[model samples]
Target: MFDNFKKNSERYRDYEVIAKFIRLAIPARWRPIGYLEHLVRSRTGGRIPKGPFAGMRYIHTAFGSAYVPKLLGIYERELNPFIEQACALNCPLIVDVGAAEGYYAIGMALRNPDARVIAFEMEQKGRAALKEMAELNNVTSRVEIRARCKRPDLAQILATSDRALILCDAEGDEETLLDPETIPMLAHTHLLVEVHEFVSAGIAERVMKRFAATHKIRRIWQEDRHRSDLPFATLGTTLLPRFYLDWSVSEWRPERMSWLWMEPRTVNAPAA
Candidate 1:
C-alpha cells in the first residue's frame, strides 16, 4: 500500500510540472492585443499594412527598438524625459508644433481627454494624416489641426489663464519658435522643445534665458553626438543629418523624477 501511495504522489508531481511548463511555453497574446488596440485607436482609420507580417509591422520602430506608432501616441523612455514630464502636468492646452501625422498630439489628447490640443504640421500629407487620426481616436472634439507655413502667434491665440503645454519638433527652427517675447505668452504653459545641436551653439541656453525669469527650464535628453547628414533621397532634399537636444519647462516646481535637465531652477515669482 505504501508503494502504491508513492507512485500516485510521483504521478501528481509530474502532472503539476507539465502544467507549469505549458503555461510558461504559451506566449502571452494579450500584450500584442493591447498594442494593436492602442494603434487602432491612435491612428483612427489608418490601415494596418496587410501582409504575412503585417501585424508585426505595426509594432516596429522607424529608428529604434521602441515601436514608432506607440512612441508617437504615448511617452516612451527613448524620447526626451521632458516629453513625458509635460504629459503628467495639469496643463489645459497642448501645442504640438511640427506634429507629424499628429502622433504626439493625438496621444496627448487621448491621455488627457479634458485638455485641448492644437496640432500644427507644415506638410500637407502630415496634416491629412493627423486629421484622420484625431477622428479615429474620437478626439476630434478636443484636438485641432492647423496646417500653416509658420508657427502660430501664441499671444494672439492663447489667454494668460489657460494652462498650456508645448511640444516642438520643428527640424531646425527651435530658435525662431522660442522668441523672447513669446515667452510671456507661455508663462503658464510647459514647453518641450527639441533643439538641434549642429545648427547653433548655446541656442538652448539663449532660449532658456528669455524665460528664466518667469519659467523653470530643464534639459531632458541630449542624443548621442552623431553626424547630422542623412541622404534625403526620399524627400528630394539634400538636408544633412543633425544632432538634437530635448528640453522642458514648468511654471512651478517640477516632480523630482520627472525633471530631466542637467540644471534646475526655482520660480522667483508668478508671471505678470
Candidate 2:
C-alpha cells in the first residue's frame, strides 16, 4: 500500500506534471508538420553530412526531424567510441534490439560493409520507416528487418556467429533479456545496452552485476548537447505547435538514460 502511494505521489511531481501537459498539448497528427519540415530540409534524401558514418543514406521518418542532431550524427558523445570499437573488430553480425526506424542499425551497416545488421522493431510505422531507410541506403541486401525478437532468438542468432555485437534499446526489457546466465551467448558478444533506470529502478545495477564476471561494463549517460542552434525560434512564428516549438529548443533526452557498453574480457582489443 505504501509503495503504491509513493508511486502515485511520484507521478504528480512537478516535472511529471509538465511532461504530461506537454504530451497532451502535442498534436496527435505531428507527422504532417514534421514531413513538411523534412521536405524543406530535403532530409529525406538521407545523406549524413559528417561524422564516422558520413555518406550513409537514411530516410528520415516524419517525426525524425525532431532529432535532427542525432540524424546528423552528433547527439551522443559516448556512442561514437563503441561504434569505433565495433567497426575495428569488424564483427560479422550486429543485432539491434528496438531499432526504431533503423537509425543505428542502418547507420552501422553503412559504416561497416562487411557486417550484416539484423534490426528488430515491432511497431508498424517503425517497420515501414526502417524498410524504406534500408532500401534508400542500398543496405537492404545487408540489413535484415525483424518484427520482434526474444532472448532465445538472440541466443540462437549469436550462437551462429563467432563474433557479434548487440546494440539494445529495448525500453525496460533489457533487465530481463540481457541476463548473461539466461542468455549465455551474451557473455561472448559485445553489447551496448540502454539501461532504463528511469522506467525500472535498480535495473542498471542488476544488469551491471550480471555481466561483471566476464565483461568490462562501462556506463555512459545521455549526451546533453542537442541541436539548439536549429532555426526553430525563427520558424516558431509559423504554423508549428507550441509543443514542438518548446521541445525543439532543448536537446532531446530522457531525464536519466545510461548506456551499458560491455566488452568481453576474453575478446582481444583490436590494434590501434
The numbered model that scores best in TM-score is 2
Global local distance difference test of model 2: 0.71
For all candidates, what are the clash counts? 7, 0
Q: Write the per-residue lDDT of candidate 2 for residues 205-253, one digit (tens) a residue.
A: 9989989999998988664432243443344325654444334433344
- How displaced is residue 138 in candidate 1, in Å? 1.3
RMSD of 2: 6.3
Please, what are the lDDT tens digits per residue for candidate 1 over residues 1-272? 23333343344445446546645766533233233334443553333332111221122222111232343222233353454565566467777888876657776786676788888888777777677777766788988888652535655545544566777766568677656474456555567776655466666677677768756666654222111211112221123111110010010111111211311233123335
Please give the distance, in angstroms, between residue 199's alpha carbon in candidate 2 and its true position after superposition.
1.3
User: What are the TM-scores, per candidate, against the unseen true structure?
Assistant: 0.54, 0.77
Provide the lowest-lDDT 10-residue window in model 2.
Answer: 1-10
Q: Candidate 1 — which pairs collide?
A: 44-136, 219-261, 228-241, 228-242, 229-240, 229-241, 230-241
